[model samples]
Target: MPTTFRQHRKQDDPVLTVDFTRFPLAPGDRVLDLGCGAGRHAFECYRRGAQVVALDQNGEEIREVAKWFAAMKEAGEAPAGATATAMEGDALNLPFPDESFDVVIISEVMEHIPDDKGVLAEMVRVLKPGGRIAITVPRYGPEKVCWALSDAYHEVEGGHIRIYKADELLGKIRQAGLRPYGTHHAHALHSPYWWLKCAFGVDNDKALPVRAYHKLLVWDIMKKPALTRVAEQLLNPVVGKSFVAYATKPHLPKAQA
Candidate 1:
């Protein structure tokens, strides 16, 4: 049976990487977090005063995310009028009508699905004209190193099926009828941590180097140390662990009959 692995995800996500300002979400905007693994981005959207829908295929994850949503509501972590909903759904065929959402987020999810283009199509289908999307995938070089280091790093069930080059991913977004606008890399400090884990053993949490690096990551995430933040920002362009692309659905010019 698959465990929740809640302990494995203690660190808050790298919010700066998503750069929500570029997406231009406003209060009451409809936001969909496709494949939201535990509602990290969804929660952020809610906090920004958007109506957030956190969708995932994993029932267990959805349940956990729903609990978090309720907790956030009870604790007033979200904005005054914000709302959130967590649901189980298929990414390839979203249960939404065309042009339904103002913003869509599919973070660190494309590499896991074999039919990536199909999933992109579904995201595009659900996005309103002029809507924006942010897609994140495991960067090619760093992910290649992890794959080279250990088969277990990605050869497991539901693991990343492929690595995506930045250009290749951008092209797929364009093919899906979205206009590519901006791109960035993120989590540069995390590349070496994964490399260490892959070098020893993916599951060897007790390994000294792995444990130390994990601690460092936890600190970097929780503390926001100035030096490490500066270093990560500098290294992100060169060796970030993930590549993020932002795109918008183009509004077609009116047809002349």
Candidate 2:
């Protein structure tokens, strides 16, 4: 993985918050981490005893994630029956049959794709009726700040093409034939860090303020200090960096006799 990707994976809380109780994940559940960059959430699902398939278009990332999956299995980090596989595949044309997976997670990815609706349609196609899906994107307000602060933040190749308002995203999910039931924001504490990077320069890692904030974030993720934890919960609702929406594919209605 690239240094920046590793840093974010290590520091950033899992954006979709894969709490099984809320997300309808069960042991042996077939889970697809669509756009599973670096496979953080995919590995988590494996550890929770799910059969996970981590798919991404980046071949190198897929290889690295596969290596990690093997290492996790060898090290016994994952549960006894859990399994994982990684593959390089396009998000818009997922290589799976309809209703193949029970859970799907796409995080911080839609903003990068030009045909987001097509991707959502693919997700819906692969999910079994009543299966759960989680979609996350950079929230409008904070993402707008980053875009305003530095064109470099979004103007690059494969960078975020648009910011998503919460309602707009949920609306798209509903349009895809999924019934949205829950929504929340996350990574509240990491918002300012991006703003600072955007303000200074995305590559200015040597800047004192950015470096300091990075350390603080790393510490918070590693140590989970109560003060920072509570602070993040309080801030998440107001300025959380990512908007997460959860929905389920609706089961077909019973035919009248």
Candidate 3:
């Protein structure tokens, strides 16, 4: 009886958008949310009736997510058939056997890994045939603005090592043996909000415009409706903050076999 958080709040944004359509989990599915920062998507999977494993390199966040999972279990917020657990693990080398999960999520994580190919291969290795994987990275245009604004923004500890173009990422996924199925942009409003922050200072949330825009973005995610819907969809392809691509492991044997 784990707790659940309704994620219907952002039907337009990229990460959650992919979760809604691309990563639709059925009851009894085994799902993996790699680099699950704070477990947002993991919680959503559990709520949607999947056994979810939320993994991250950060032990603290994993601990917090585990605590929340425990609390949710006690509070009876999770779906009747779903459960969740959190663990610490690295993306480049996952701690699971081949074909371990029916679905895998890697949201806003690939950019942080230098060997993104290795990470993708690990994800592919653990996915069951015909299993799905959803990946989200900062969209090229918006990320370029941040790069132009400050060298330090992407140069500091745990900072992004590379910004991916959608096509390039899709190609990479294909190279890792997954078949691309769909692509979309999300968090359109948040792009300019982050642009404002990067222009001010990446860490300067205290600045007036940055602070104000941050609040607005938070409000938009919390109370999503018609206006945000039109705005996000209209802005996504052009200026969305994140690019999400969904793919599946083709259910075919290797050509050599």
Candidate 4:
């Protein structure tokens, strides 16, 4: 049985919605997990048989993720021939060369960086032609509620600098010369939870409603059943908290004479 968020709220987690396995990650594909805070999606890529480069700006998170990758490697948890390495790097200026990675995952990351355009450029630069990139950010509506409730929510260090609307984000990606392909929302049940937190205080753990909602979300993530599935699916298009946009690097040739 595959582990869900509930069973293990570990640093390395498999997010069901992103569906990393669906990507065409063969044995030798190079995958980059940009802004990989704790190697959650990066570990998933490694487990799914891709060579993963987990990059993060936070030194501590990078250290922890590196440890987990080493541990996973020793334990033989990663797919045969799959490997991962965590590196401390800035998203705006990726340390890798152009066309270095076949796939790039940037989940819940762009919102935190100020120069998101620079980051997107770096993502597009490192990705090989015809490679795919997946980016996730807080959906507009839910993020607006949080912003309206508390300026402090976005003011702190490592906090979200901006909330991205679906079209705006995709447009920026397209401007960087990538072709947007598919988009979806995720974590539908968790929106109200953040709303409650923002209503009370972004850091207020004493709020009963927030605590209760958090537990419920944890429960839902852990024990996936028919009811939650239907509810999440129905709610996703309406009130999902995170928006995921997938795009591919354009590979079309110039018009010939």
Candidate 5:
């Protein structure tokens, strides 16, 4: 997530990283959307009949998320038995009992936090044994390009602090006592948008190139044109903006008498 004007808008559709097909969300599952920036995943989980909790440190985002969840409920968007909650909280110190959640998702958030492993440990602690986790981070290559292009892209407070290579992140997941089952990349078409932003200026969304690229991204996301979709699929492995990994908290072994 680059420090851009894009962060301010309420995304009509979630900018998804974890594919639902791979990390399935069952009905009534207790899901924690840790560091849920704009409650995108939380809203999806709610629509899927899960008991969803969207937690973030930013109270403003939390309030807006809560409103959206409420609106969804009033509009009958969430199915019967699906519940959603938005709360302001810290990722490093989750305010939940041990084994509290059936699923946890932290998307495009760890890179902003300094103690990435500490956040992982907390997520592992709250997740029930055999529960699944979906973790997403900015891919190193594209992120490095943004950094090289402009300092303002990531130098600000609450901006991305580090990029994660696939192996390095997988190793951390293992260290956190989770067994990684699957991994993938997403938002391949969105990478160039940030590169343009960095080259022009992180805040200069008005730049002609930036404006043009932004429209292209908005078109792809909202309209989902077949051409761009196919192009994204082809390019994801090589230059996806986000790296997604799915893992499970291992159940402890039984002891012999």
Candidate 6:
């Protein structure tokens, strides 16, 4: 869904946009990672002992994820009751039945699709009552800067089609019949790296500044030293690159006779 430099989640530990501390997961909970590019979040959920289904329209990525899941299972990376599945499926039409999942996550996926509301509706439909959902997108300010700097950044197919402000996204969640409880920004440090990419060329990873920034991000994600962690936390509220929101589906009232 996201064709940005942030898609470089190839590390042993995936760089997750959702903070599990806030959106907690338990063992055996049914979890879905819609638009699960590279199976980053799905891998994390598997490790956390959830029954995970990583779905994506990209058949190639789905195959790769399935391989990794098998490897994890064989290696005992996932705990005793944790099952994992990776399948190619459309976000607009999920194959699961109603009230099928305890948690649903769609990160960096909504902006690429034209019918954002349709995607939200599908998420609401599949999530069980009281089940949680996390949605993340490119934040408005940083995304606007990238748009201003480079048309090539968002003009390509499967690139980000729209940047969303926090309130706007939360409102859509409410409209989808989910009650949003909390929200925050993430990846403040990576914003500038993307900005640099936009200024240079989205595909030109060989550029000097882009290459330099790429090293810094890999180091930050891998080692996660105190300095960058603290810096990202402090800067997140202001210039963070991605906006994350957590919501839960509510039970319906009884019908009148």
Model 5: lDDT of residue 26: 93
Candidate with maximal lDDT: 6
All candidates' lDDT scores? 0.87, 0.88, 0.84, 0.83, 0.90, 0.90
lDDT of 3 by residue, 1-257 (tens): 22132243142233364547655778989999999997778877876889999999999999988887776666666778787889999888889999999999998888998899999999999999999999999999999999999887799989899989888999999999999988888878888887887889888879999989878777766676679879888988899889989999989767894
List TM-score per model, in order. Answer: 0.93, 0.93, 0.91, 0.91, 0.94, 0.94
- In the range 1-257, model 2's lDDT, one tens digit per residue, is 34444444455343335445567668899999999998878977887899999999999999998987877776666787788999999999999999999999998999999999999999999999989999989999999999999999999999999998888999999999999998888889989999999999999999999999999987888677899989988999998998888899999999999
What lDDT does candidate 6 reach at residue 36?
96
- In the range 52-128, model 4's lDDT, one tens digit per residue, is 99999899999988877776776667778887889999898889999999999998888988889999989999999
| Candidate 3: 10-residue stretch with minimal lDDT | 3-12
Q: Model 1, 1-257: lDDT tens per residue?
A: 01222222335555445777666679999999999997788877887899999999999999998887776676666787788999999999899999999999999999999999999999989999999999989899999999999999999999999988888888888889999999888889989999999999999999999999998888887677899989998999999998989999999899999
Choose 3 or 5, whichever is better by lDDT: 5
Specify the poorest-scoring 10-residue window by lDDT in model 6: 1-10
Q: Mind giving the per-residue lDDT tens digits that candidate 6 earns over 73-158?
A: 76667899999999999899999999999999999999999999999999988999989999999999999999999999999989
| Model 3 C-alpha lDDT versus the unseen true structure | 0.84
Model 5 lDDT per residue over 71-103, tens place: 787767789999999999999999999999999
Q: Can you rank all candidates by lDDT, best first?
A: 6, 5, 2, 1, 3, 4
Off by over 4 Å in 6: 1-14
Better of 4 and 6 by TM-score: 6
After the best TM-score superposition of candidate 5, give how far the Cα of residue 120 lies from its true spot, in angstroms: 0.7
User: Model 3, residue 102: what's the lDDT?
Assistant: 97
* Winner by TM-score between candidate 5 and candidate 2: 5
For every model in order, what is the number of clashing pairs? 0, 0, 6, 1, 0, 0
Q: Which stretches of candidate 3 lie over 4 Å from their true place?
A: 1-17, 254-257
Give Cα distance to truth, residue 235, candidate 5, Å. 0.5
